[model samples]
Target chain A: MIAFRNVTHGYGDGPLLSDVSLTLPPGSFHFLTGPSGAGKSTFLKLCYRELMPIAGTVEIFGQDVSHMSRDAVAMARRKIGVVHQDCQFLDHLPLADNVALPLTVAGREANPEELKELLAWVGLSGHARARPPSLSGGERQRAALARAVITAPEMVLADEPTGNLDWDMSQRLLTLLVELNRMGKTILIATHDMNLIRTAKSQVAARVLRIRDRTVQHAGADL
Target chain B: MKAPLPRKFRLFGRDTRTDRVVPPSGAAAWLTLLTAAAMAFLAVFALALSVATGRLADRWSEALANGATVRISAPADQMATQTQRVLDILSVTPGVETARALDPAETQALLSPWFGPDLPVASLPIPQLIDIQETPQGFDAEGLRLRLSAEVPGATLDDHQRWRRPLVAAADRMRMLGLISLALIGAAMAAMVTLAAMAALSANGQVIRTLRLIGARDGYVARAFVRRFTTRTLTGAAAGTAVAMTAIALMPSAGDAGGFLTDIAFQGAEWLWPLTIPPLAAIVAFVATRTAALRSLRTVL
Candidate 1:
C-alpha cells in the first residue's frame, strides 16, 4: 500500500506534482494519466523511495519512505516491484538472468523449472540465453514485466511499461498485470495511452488518476 | 549452448551470486592488477632492505660489543710500561676475555691503509695500543675508563661508542627508511585500487541502476566489485612477489663480506615475509574498492 500526503516534487524549474495526497489500497489496480513530462515517472519514483518529495511525506506499507535507511528502502523495494518505461536491463546478462534479477537480488534461488515457465509465459523462452541489447523493444517490455512479478511482490508500480510494445503485446502484458491483481498484487501503472486504460477497465475494475495543473485529480469518465 | 552458471554458490557467503553482478571491465580490472603487482614488487624489495639492514645493524652492534681498544700516549721511554700496565689492568677485569699489546708491525698494518708504510711506526711517537676482547656481558666501560685514566695517566679506553653509535644509527635509519617505503607502497596500492574502482563504478553506473531497480541493496551491489577487485589484487600481488623474489634470488649474493647493496635479500625464514604481500594487498583492495563502491552507489543510486 502507498500513501502520499501533500507531496510536492519538481526538477528545480517549478512544482510538477504539487499538494498531492492519494492512497493506493491493497490489491487495487489504478492508472496514472498525464501528458509528456507531466511527472508520471516522478510519482512512481516517490512511491518506491527512489526520490524523496520536496515537501510532505510518501509512505509505503505504513512506513514513511523519507525516513527509511538505504537498506530499509531496499527491503521495502523487494515488496514493491517497479517497471520503468525505458525498461533498463543489464545488457551483459542473458535474458533469463535479467528476468530472474528480482529474485536474485532478493538473495533467493530461482527454481530452474519455474524460471523456464516464467520465460515461456512472457513468450521469451527462446531468448533465454540472449542478452538484453539483442532483444527487440517488445521482447524487452515483456521481459521487464516478467522481472517485476518474479519476486511475487505485494505491489507492482509500472511507469509506461508497454510504451514499446505493440497492440497485441500490450494487451497480453495488460492481461498479465490484471491476473496479478486478481491474485491480490496491487498494480499502479502510469501511461498516456487511453486505449490501454479503457481496455484494462473492461477486463478489471480500475480507477484512473490524472496529473494536471501540478496535482493529481480523480479523472472524469472522458475516455 | 553453454551450461548456465549455478545460481546457488555460498562460497563467500550466501551472496556469492552477487559477486559477478558487475560486468567484466577489462581495462579497469587490468589496471587494478598491474597497480597491485607493481606496488607489491616494490614492497618486496622494501621488506628485503629492512631485513638486511636489521641484520647489518645487529652484526655491527655485536662486533662493537665484543671488543675495546686501549691506547697509551706516554713518552717513548715510558710507552712499554704504560702498555704493560694497561694489559695487566684488562687481565684482572671481570668481563675481559683476552688482552694483549699490539706489536709494532701489527700496529703499523692498521695505519698503512690511511697513512701508508712511509710513516714508519717504530721511529714515530705513535701511541702504543692494546686490543681487549670482552665477555658477552662485557666489563663496565665507564668504570674501566676511570681506572685507566687514574692508574695510567696517559692511557685511554676506547669502548668504540663513537664508532658504534654512528654505524648502528645509520643502519637503523636505513631499516626505518625501508619500513617507511613499505608503508608508502601500501598507500600507493590503495590509491591505485581506489581510482580503478571509481572508474569501474562510473562505467558501470547503468549496471548499478539496473541492479538497484531490481531491488539489490548497496551492500549487495558493492560486494560484487569488492570481491572482483580484491581477488585481482591478490593474484597480481602474488605474481609480483614471486617474480621479485626470484629476481632477488638470481642477483649476485656476496654474503656478509659482500657490499650491503649487493647482499639485499631475505635470509632464512625471512623469505616467508614477502608471502604476506599478496594478502595484505588483497586487504587494501578490499577496503579501497568497498569504500569507493559504497560512495559511488550513494551518489548514483
Candidate 2:
C-alpha cells in the first residue's frame, strides 16, 4: 500500500502536481490517466522512492520513502515491481540474465526451470539467449514485465508499458495486468490510452483517476 | 523465496572477476600494468642491492676487526730484529690469539697478481710484515701501535680500520639508496593504481549509473572495481618478480668469475625477500584503487 499525504511535487519554477493527497489501499487496482507532461511518471517514481517529493512525503507499507537508506529503498522496491516505458537493461547480458537480474542483484540464484517457465509465461521462452538490442518493442515490453514480477512483488507500478505496442499487443499486456490483479497484486498503470482503460474497466473494477489542473479527479464512467 | 545477501555483504564467496576489462587497446589498463611491472622490477633490484650491501658490511666488519699488520720498514740489517721485537710485543698481548712473521714466499703470493710472478722478492728489500690475529675482544690497536713505536722504531701497525670504515660507509649508503628506491617504487605503484581505477570507473559510467538507479551502495560498487584492480596488480607484479628473479638467477656466479656483481645476489634465505613483493603490490593496489573508487563514486552520486 502507498500513501501520499498532501504531496506537492514540481520541477524548478513550476508545479506539476500540487497539494495532492491520495492513499492506495491494499489489494486495490487503479488506472491513472493523464495528458502529456502531467507528472504521471514523476508520481510513480515517488511511489517507488526513485524521486523524493519536493514538499510532502510518500509512504510505502508504512515506511517513509524520504528517510529510507539506499539499501532499505532497494529492499522496499523488491516488494513493488515497476515496468518503465523504455525497459532499461544491462545490454551486455542475455535476455534470460536480464529477466533474472532482480534475483541476481538480490543475490539469489534462479532455478533455471522456474526462470524458463517465467520466460514462457511472458512468451519469451525461445529468446532466452537473445540480447536486449535484438528484441522487438513488444518483446522488450514483455521481457520488462517478466523482470518486474520475477520477485512476485505485492504491488505493480507501470508507466506506459504498452505505449509502443500494437492494439493486439496492448490488449495482451492488459490481460497480463488483469491476471496479476486477479491474483491480489495491487496495480497502478499510468497511460493516455482510453480504449485500454475502458477495456481494463470492463474486465475488472478499476477506478480511473485523471491528472490535470495540477490535481487528480475521478474520471468515473466518462473514461 | 528467501532474499539473499548482496555481494558486498558476503564474507566469503567465489572470486569476483572484473566486470569491465578494458579492451586490448585500453590505454589505462596497459599503462597501469606496465607501470606496476616496471616498479616491481626496480623494487626487486633494490632488494638485491640492499641484501648484497648487508652481506658486504658484515663480511668487512668481521674480517677486518680481528687482524692487524705490523710493517717494519727499517734499515735492511735491522728489519729481522725489529720484526722479532714487534712479534714479541704482540705475542705478550692478552687479546692476541696468534702472531706470526710472514715469510718471503707468503708475502710474494700477496703481491703476485699486481707485480708479476717473477718478482725478485729475496733481492729487493720489501718490509718485514708480522700478521696478528685477535680474539673477539681484540687487542687495542692504539696500545699496540704505541708499544711497537717505543720497542721497534720503524714498526707501523695497520689495524685495517682505515680501509674497512670507508667500505662500511659505502655499503651503508648503498643500503639507504636501496631503501629510497623501494619507497619511490611503492609511491609510483599507488599513483598508477589510483589513475587506473579512475579510468576504469569513468569508462564504466553507464554500469555505475545503472547500479545506482537500482539502489547499490557506494561500497558495493567500489568492491567490484577494487577487486578487479587488486587482482590485476598482483598478477602483473608476480610476472615482473618472476622475470626479475630469473634475470638475477642467471647472473654470473661469484665463484672466481663475475667479481663484485656476482656477490651482489641474494644470500642464504635472502631469496625469500623478493617473494614478498607481489603480495605487497596487491595490498598497495587494493588500498589505492578502493580509495579512488569510493571517492570518485561519492562525487558522482
Candidate 3:
C-alpha cells in the first residue's frame, strides 16, 4: 500500500513529475508506461522512499516518508521489493548468496531448500554456484526478481525489468510476475515497452498508467 | 508449529558470507596493522620509561630524604680535630641516628672514579667527610647549620635537600613526559585508523549502496569494517608487544652498574603492564573505525 498525494519532484531544475497523485492498493497489479525521461523511474523511486517528493506527500504503509528516520526507512524497505533496470548484484558473490541477501540483511539464516526452490522458480537453479558476473542479462534479471521476492514483501516495484532481455525472456519474466500477482502480491512495473504491455494484458488484467507532460494519466483501452 | 531460533549472534563470530559483502581492502588492512604495531612498540617503551622513572624517583627520594653530610675543611694539622668536633655535634643532635667520619681509604674509594686509584690522600689537603644518618623525624637543617656555624667555623651541614628536590622533580617530570608520549602515540594510532577506515569506506561505496538496497542498517554496515580493523590491530599489537617485552627482558639489569639508561626496563610486576597494549590498541581501532564507518555511511547511504 503506497500512496502519492499530489507529489511534485525534480532535480535542481524544474519538476519532472508534477502534481501527481496515485494509490497502489493491496493485491493489485499496475503498469507504468511513458516515453524516455518522462519520470517513470522517478515515480517508482518515490513509492519506495528512495527519493522524497519536493512538494506534496508520499506515504508507504500509511506512514509519511519525509518523517521516517533512516532506520525506519530501512525497516519499511523490507516490506517492498524493487528490481532496478541494471539489476544490481554483489558481483563477488555467487548467485545463491546474492539472492539470499535480503534474509541475511534481516539477520536471519537462509534456508537452503527454500533458496534452491526460489532459484529454480527464477530459472537460475543451474547457476547457483556461479558468480553474478558470469550470468547472462536475462539470467541476471531473473535472479534479481528472485532476490526481490525472497523476503515475501507485500509490494513489488520493478523498473524496466525487460529492458535488456529478448522477447521470449521478457515473456518468461512477465509470467513469473503474473504468477506472483496471482498469489496476491501487489505489483507495479515501469517500462516503455508496448509489446510487453500487450503481452501482460493477455496474461493478467493490469491497469496501465502513462506519464506524459510531467503528469500521470490513466491510459484506457487506447494504449 | 514454530521455527527454531538461530544461534546467538556473537560479537566476534565469523560469518564469512557477511564479511565478504565488503571486499577485503588489502592495502588499508596492511597499513592499519603496521601502524598499530609501530604505535604499540612505542607504547611499550613509553610505559617502561614511566615505570622506571617512577621507581628512580622513589629510590632517590627515600635515600636522600633522611641523610646529611658534614664536610670539615681545615689545615692538615687540625683535620682530625675538626672531624672529631663535627662527630661530637652529630652525637648530641636530636634526630641523628648515626654519625661516622669516613676513613682515608673510604674517602679514597669515593674519589677513585674522579682522581684515579693511586692518589696520595695523606699528603693532599682533602677535606674530612662525616656521613650522618637521620631518624624518621629528621632534625631541622637551619637549626643545625646555625649551631655548626657558631661551634665549628669550618664545618658545613648539608641536608641534601637542594640537590634531592631537583633530582626527584626531574624524575617525576620524566615520568609525566613518558605518559604524555603514550597518549600521543594512542592518538596517532587512532588518526591513522580513522584515515584508513575512511579510505576503505570510500573505495567500497558500491558495496555500501548494494547493502543498503537490501535493507541493511547503518550498524550492520559499520560492523563489517569495524570488525576487520579491530582484529587486525589486535593481532599486530600483540606481535609488537611480544617483541618489545622480549627486548626489555633481555636488557641489562641495574645491579652494580646502576646507570640511568641501563635501567630503562620493567621491574618485577611491571612486566605485566605491556600486556595491556594489545587490548588497548584494539579498543582504539574499534572506536576509530566505528566512528568513520558510521559517519561515511550517513553520507553515502
Candidate ordering by DockQ (highest first): 1, 3, 2
Q: Give the Cα error of residue A220 in candidate 1, in Å.
A: 3.3
lDDT of 1 by residue, A136-159 (tens): 888888888889888889999988
Per residue, candidate 2 scores C-alpha lDDT tens digits across B1-301 of 9898865433235633224212222676667777778878889999998888878788888888888888889888888787778777887998999999999999999989999899999889798888889998888888888887887889998999899899988988888888888988998899989988888788777666555544455666777777667777888898889899889888877685665578778867999999999889989998898888877775542
The runs of at least 3 residues in candidate 1 whose Cα sits more than 4 Å from the true structure, single-residue gaps closed, are B1-16, B74-77, B115-126
Interface RMSD in angstroms for candidate 1: 1.3
Candidates arranged by TM-score, highest first:
3, 1, 2
lDDT tens digits, residue span B6-49, model 1:
43211234455676578888778788778888889999999999
Model 2 steric clash pairs: none
Reference-based TM-score, model 2: 0.83
Q: Give the per-residue Cα lDDT of candidate 2 at B199.
A: 82
User: Total clashing residue pairs per candidate?
Assistant: 0, 0, 0
Q: List the residue pairs that clash in candidate 3.
A: none
TM-score of the A chain in candidate 2: the value is 0.95
Interface RMSD for each predicted structure: 1.3, 3.8, 1.3
Quote the positional error of residue B180 for candidate 1 in Å: 0.9
Tens digit of per-residue lDDT, candidate 2, span A29-107: 8988888889889888889876778888889989988787766776787788888877877777788987877776665
Please tell me which predicted candidate would have the highest TM-score against the true structure. Answer: 3
